[model samples]
Target: MKLKHILIGVGVLLALILVLKFTGVIGGEKTEKVTVEAAGNKKVVETVTASGKIQPETEVKLSSEVSGEVTELLVKEGDVVKKGQLLCKVRPDILQSGYERAVASYNSQKATVASTQQQLIQNQANFANASATYKRNVELYNKKVISASEFDAAKAAYLTAQANLASAKENVTGAKFGLEQSGANVKEAGANLARTTIYSPVDGVVSKLSIELGDRILGTSQMAGTEIMRISNLSSMEVNVDVNENDINRVNVGDSATIEVDAFADKKFKGIVTEIASSSTSVGTASTSVDQVTNFSVKVRILADSYSSVKGGAKDLPSPFRPGLSATVDIESESLTSLAVPIQAIFTGDKEKSPSQAATATNDQSQDKQKAKLNDKNIKQYVYLFDSKASTVKKAEVTTGIQDDQYIIVKTGLKAGQEIVSGPYSAIQNKLKDGLKVEKTTKDKLFSADGKN
Candidate 1:
């Protein structure tokens, strides 16, 4: 009986060893499970995304030049109008009165000029009579036919008439100058009065109306006046977006774009980059803060043919997109096919020696640095490559280029068809060490208890 008990004990011990090996606790199966992807050629397009408002390609802001109440508002917001069409009118009480005063002044000056001309004509006749009388008096004095008193009296009257004629001519010249001054005033007052009547400068819809009937407004001539309304060419639409300064270098005019408007959630509009601002600011407004994020303004014009479905049916209906609808734009700067890997597979490795450093580590300092990678605190970007022969992951330093939504282009240090740890971010980021034993597995299996590939 003692011998049989010993044999049963040995069998139980053997079963325990087999269980340990199966669970990967004390065998070669001990390894971290990680998801891997084979690097391959992929089509990649670099893009820069930005958010902004949809604006008309052509828009004109209307403002009054004369301050007054908006007495006559001919069109409301969203009303379509034509060039030179009457849009609104300001109260013309003060302006009309001034214009009338200028007209009266001009007419009065004209009458004064005419009266002075008549006086000048009479003075000319008087001057002619004075000269003839003076000649006759001289002849009479020479012949002694008349007394000295008569001759002197005639000469004095002739001198007085000559002075009066010269004065009359001077009065006519002064009156003509006054007429010219009054004419200038009339023109200026007329121009100011015309400004009270607003007209559409272009054919468009009134996208914005800032004034109601009888609302008082300041004129632009005096200050930054109230904007009466905005006329927009709705058929021609564009988005004015602010892109990050970091990404603005990748954007250029004539680049294709995909625009997503907040209002049209279901549709994506096609666009082309039309303009790029040379100067950068803090988004819409200028800011002087050192921490402020800089952004460049870019304009993307939505193609007319692409949005025909959303166009208004009749002249009375407004356009589909107003002047300030929110929109997001993705400008595609470039596209190419290159060897790429999932971005998730890459992570910053702590204190690891770079590939170049390790390759040419003949110097003492370089060798020391390579040896201290395990304990050094310096960090650099790296990816884990799967070695099929050893069933392990090797840390590799990689050079990367531009990336899109999913994959990043591997510029160097990687080849096509090579397996790379793609996921189980926790393992790729922290758990996997250089030459660490690893097993291929699905992303979901990385979290399983057994960790089997």
Candidate 2:
């Protein structure tokens, strides 16, 4: 009977222990633990990231000015050339024939001009002789020495000569005009012939060559000509990146940038913002929505002096970087020194009222107004301040200014050295509320240990 009593007592003790464990009577209520940080003054640098390709600052694409088959290709890709260097030659047979015809026409016009001038001189001489003869005849008629019919015939002869002279002068003017027209035609033909022989207009490297021997190209006079090749001055380079519309306003000419190319994995190039587009480029169109993504093109000129000194002192790099290499740029848009906290610490909702309070106070208009005032979207940015004495957190509404990769600038509502809950994102974003019991812990302790909180 005593053994049975002892077994009963042990069983009762075990039941009591299980009840206390399940009901939290022995360990007490568990408080949600969170990492906290002290808001302090620090420099917050704002940057905009963009991807683009490397291109020569001075690049010229060459195209055919006259349509013809490329008969002679003198330069290939990667060949360095100087101004006026012969790059290629197109088949000049057709152009030569047209030029010869123009020359013949011009010569013919010149001969016609000469003939008209000679005829004009002869007509002037005839007019002078007729005038002298008419004057003599008029004087003789006035002296009653010549017959009336003869005087009238002399007057008619002089009028005919004057008319002929006028006609000859007009013919000379027309012939001269025709000669000028033919001369212009000849010049045009000559220009066309010259166009068949392509010459480098600037000193550059032949970065791209699209035409081989015997390839036909179109002329630009009629349409956009076939792009035969590209010549680029590789000594100067630039990166063309597209900036999103939201960040474009902060970017300006002369802003400093850091450029990284895919080819040079370990090196970073320095650049400056050289150009910004005035208009936005549409990246995509949504069929069912009014929202569209737009980007503005920005040009960053690589500083040669700065680029020469890479991370390891510019060793093992190509003499001139090739075009079309993938690159990324980070533009330093703004910087400020202000009281700040980790970006994760700032939450959007009101931390002053718990959900239960909000639900219970719905019938009270004054409480509703207070909730509405706190829930206003315009001033919703806030952080949780840890009340050390009460061991609770209170929502402190804040005005934020700028942010860097990890931290944000607090423009108002928070002071330097004030301790605030930093993370365990869920606790601050969803669970924790005003007057909630909490325990302070470091992020490392909360995340590294498996059973701490």
What's every prediction's RMSD, in angstroms? 7.9, 7.0
Model 2: CA > 4 A from native: 1-27, 283-289, 311-320, 350-379, 450-453
Query: Which pairs, if any, clash in model 2?
Result: none
Model 1 weakest 10-residue run by lDDT: 368-377
- Candidate 1 lDDT at 319 equals 48
| TM-score of each candidate structure, all chains considered together | 0.80, 0.84
Model 2 lDDT at residue 15: 95
Residues 1-453, candidate 1: write the lDDT tens digits.
Answer: 999999999999999999987877867544777888999999888788899999889999887788888889899888889999998888889989999999999999999999999999999999899889989989989999989999999999899999999999999999999999999999999999999998999999888888899899999685667888999888888999999887888898999999998878888889999999988855456447778888888999999777778644334544477677899999999887899887667665553335454334433454334223322224455788899888888888887766666777888889999999886654564567888888788866665753452
lDDT of 2 by residue, 49-89 (tens): 99999888888998888888888999988888999999999
Question: Which structure among the candidates has the greatest lDDT?
Answer: 2
- For candidate 1, the per-residue lDDT at 272 reads 99
